[model samples]
Target: MFSLYALAQQAPSIDLIISNCKVINMADGSITQGQSVAIKNGKIIDVHSDKYIKNKYQAAQYIQAEGRYVMPGLWDMHMHFGGGDSTLHENKNFLALYLAHGVTSIRDMAADISKSVVKWRDEINNDQLTGPRIFTSGPKLEGYKPIWKGVLQVGTPEEVESALDSLQKLNVDFVKITENTLKPDIYLYALKAVKARGLRSSAHIPSSLTLNEVIDAGLNSVEHLGYAYNAGIPKAATASKASQFNAEYAKQQYRYMANHHVFITPTLLGSYIISHLDEDSHTNDAYLKYIGRGIKNTYSWRVDRAKNISAEASKQRHENYDNVSKILPLLQSEGVKIMAGTDAGYLNSFVYPGIGIHQELALMVKAGLSPLQALQASVVNSPAFLGLTEYGSVAKDKRADLILLDQNPIENIEATQKIHSVIVKGVVFDRRQLDKFLKDVADQNVSGL
Candidate 1:
């Protein structure tokens, strides 16, 4: 029942109010303290010293931010929510879970179920859901055959044309193309078609395509760092002709991406677990409580498989993860627009959806990204890359997608876990409220009684 119109009437009409925040404005490299932020409806109406705002405007409800660092609620760009129907039901709870953890928006990278997600997107805009804003590819585009269910399979040039046309009719948020599942030629054709329809195209870069081919085809964005690595290989130009997924051949793809202006997500944590999962027991993970039971059973098979791999091969994967860690800083220095996305899902085992992102940020920090820079990867940088002008920053006229933390995240990125409050779509939830929501979910999910 709470929409922007309903919330605005109760908005701050008062002059100066206090939020007592340690602020991180990733926009201008500004970090300040004891400041107050003002709100009008769901947009940040003003942000000034408490006294100044108090004397200037009349307010209705004053949020006592008290010793908190107020920053933008996060946007996780690389999320997916379906392999089958059970996930569609779970998607409703998924939104609340993200919001509970301060994620205000999510870009789904193609779920098998499209109808519910699209409906969820519209309903969230209409204030019908209490979760993050959903932006989705709806379904993935593959070639020759639909290796996964709910895909828009394009086998030839005409099929590519038809799929592109269907995207428009379905009115999806973006386009997601996978590599191994499709032929590069027709996939490129589909990318061109996406552009012609005025939609942004992003994909798991086919190792076969050179970085130049991707940029030349006008790819809107590339999804992961591994893909960028392939593009770095000079012979990737020839790989497209032969259609091979040889990472070693495309080793220096980062340089090509930097030169040609392509973006990479580098969902390191998800990759970290997937590639090196055999290293740790899922039951022993620090954040295991955050994983729901339904999802935890799915993780056992992978962990069991990890136990059989040679210790030497396992050691090599750890080494690869360590090497991959360096890409975060390298991309930053090369002027690559890196956005934080967690390929966190049921299939990805151990990388729980909500908490895995915090782990991802910590890994990025270990790899030399400043805490400020890492926050930008999740917040300001993500919306900027997605061209979402209204939601990322905590500024006047920006949507009220803000999170208040007990500690300054710039000082320690893990301070993100000390969440105190979150304001999503103008509805505010303090720590107690969030705790209750999570508890109720846990009880209902576990007991169903």
Candidate 2:
């Protein structure tokens, strides 16, 4: 004997509900106050006024946002996870570091451990692993007998086709091409071919060609600011040849980048770390405790290279870093999309996985991007660059990858580093849990130096 009115009034069921928060809209940095967000099965089902959420829905779990600032989780667009077979476990530990720092997604630019990385990517997606969502370029493309390990070496058009065929079989998220022994023509050929196959591409623009040439050939993103900066130099049309520093040519190149809509990842922190190597030896960085021996050993070659340089050479290196960083604000003014990546991994010195992103945002701010713009580089621009439509904003029907900050990041970018909690795939990791994650990573075993 059920009342008809009662039978008709069943509340909607949701997996989790977050209440009493100010949601930051990355779309334009607006704040929707006193909102409640309902999530079901990892996707945000609805966002509404708190009263509507309380009246119409029931959830298995409730997280009180307590007037905190909630926005999409950070994304590190360029990082790596490889140090040959011996460092596999060591590299895997980086996942915990990333999550503890409120970074919920990472783009693994190719490394020597593609097989292990691809497996981990799937596990994370299927809920079998505890880590960020991984988007990887499976074993990058290289030229014949290239120096980099785990690359598909191609010397001719036929070889390029076969290499792309292999990448398709591996089901990579995108293709990464480097200039290490790769010929300029074949690099262009690979870009065009990858595009023809309907695949997205990222690459180290060959110094032999103008930046515009690669953009014309279908390169979606440039991996470093140095390359973009090189393009901005007058007649910098080619890296191998010397040309006058033409300010007009540089303006044209930047204008061209704006017109073509090319994406650029400055990876300022890593470059800055190297540029300042003369002053900061980084031998006593506290973050080094989390890095394993094998990975730390990988950092030696670059460190040695920096140390061996003469005083004049070191001065030039600092000048190069300063000059290249100047392009950041210019790119912003030109409407070029800039992605924030730390380049924090093997062979890159002192750039830790988790906390390095915050440093990157700070550097971007120092380079003339506003705090909102710096945050956008990570939360909004990274996803947009990769075309990952499921993320990049806090909205209804979006994936529940978010961060809750004690202070509004819009007001101060450093506030992002003060994370209160993180929600990954609708699962909440409160501050205590985040701290425990750091401890667990710290406690993992690594070999002695």
Q: What is the TM-score of each candidate against the true structure?
A: 0.89, 0.94
lDDT of 1 by residue, 1-449 (tens): 56755655554474324377766777664787767888776777788887767656666667887767788988788887765666454446667678778888888888677877888888888977667888888888886555466788777888787777777777888888877678888778877777777888888777667677777787867887666654544552554422443344443455556676667788888768866766565667755555556556656666676767887978877876675566567668767778888887655677766776788888889889999888888997788766778866767888778888888788899998888888886678888988876776666566632
RMSD of 2: 2.6
Judged by lDDT, which candidate is best? 2
Stretches of candidate 1 exceeding 4 Å from the true structure: 1-18, 236-260, 284-294, 297-305
Q: State candidate 2's TM-score.
A: 0.94
Q: Looking at model 2, which ten-residue stretch has the lowest summed lDDT?
A: 236-245
Candidate 2 per-residue C-alpha lDDT over 1-449 given as tens digits, one digit per residue, 9 for 90 to 100 = 47655643688878899999999988677899999989999989898889989887889999899999999999999998888989898899899999999999999999899989999999998999999999999999999788688888988999999999988888899999998999999999999999999998989988779888999999888898888777866552445312344446666787787788778899999999998899899999988988988899999988998887889988988887877787788888878888999999887999999999999999999888988899888988888877778887888878999998889888888999989999999999999999998887777743332
Segments in model 2 whose C-alpha atoms lie over 4 Å from true places = 1-9, 236-248, 446-449
Candidate 2 local distance difference test against the native: 0.88
